[model samples]
Target: MKTNKLILIFCLIFSVHSFAQPKMEEKKEQIRALKVGFITNELKLTADEATKFWPLYNAYDDKQFELRHQKMKAFKGRMEADLDKMSEKEAAALLAQMESNEDELYQIRKKFVTSLKGILPSVKIIKLKKAEDDFNKKLLEQYRNKGPRR
Candidate 1:
């Protein structure tokens, strides 16, 4: 009987999550649109430059997404448990793994920058980085203004 109750609860959770997926996707699309608009206006991309720039930019974005997802999956269990209660060895190992992941992300950024060199001028590339930082800061401010989410 307890097992049956547990199964029912699991099913309910899954159904609720599935129902929320469409709205989650809509939010992602909205954010992507906002980001593109912000980048376009901030960078002052020429029509010809935009045409050549977007595909390469998308690849860089995808690499960031891939690296983030990889790190999340790799550290999935590490986040759920209380870190303060963990053994010294466990914490040390976690720190090592985190550092390694950060190094990998840094290398990925370096490679992406190298790939962007011939296609994009240094000024535009710097502008892109600045635009990204500004966009992120604005998003954070908006979220803060909205207060804590449930």
Candidate 2:
């Protein structure tokens, strides 16, 4: 009877986790849609410009997302390590790895902006950056105002 209860508990936990994963992905999709609309409106993209812009922008966004995921994973691993017991050499290496990740993120941004120069006016590209910042700020403000999730 005890073994059966343990099995049931494990199954329940697994099912809940599976359900939660889809909901998390759904929320990500919704936010992505909202960002697209926000950016489109902010840029005042013409149909021709949007046709040329979104593909390049989406590719750049995907690369940035992947790099951020890698950086966060590395950060989490470092957090889990016993820093007090770590050697100077190991700590230096981790610091170097963190710096390298940041440099790579910067390089990707530089390349994306350079590519945008060919597709957009400098003024519009600057506006794109502002729009991105504004969207992020608004999203953060909304999240903060909502308070902590239960």
* Local lDDT at 1 for model 1: 39
Give the per-residue lDDT of model 1 (tens digit) for 1-150: 343344445544554444345577665655665667677777777677778777887787887878788776878788679978999999889889888888988888888778778777899889989999998998788668866546
- The CA-based lDDT of model 1 is what? 0.74
Error of 2 at 27 (Å): 0.9
Q: What are the candidates' C-alpha RMSDs?
A: 13.9, 13.5
Q: Tell me the number of clashing residue pairs for each predicted model.
A: 0, 0
How far does residue 111 in candidate 2 sit from its true spot (Å)?
0.8
Q: What lDDT score is found at residue 68 in candidate 2?
A: 91
lDDT per residue (tens digit) for residues 49-147 in model 2? 788999999999999999899677978788688989989998898888889888998999999999999888999999999999998997787669866
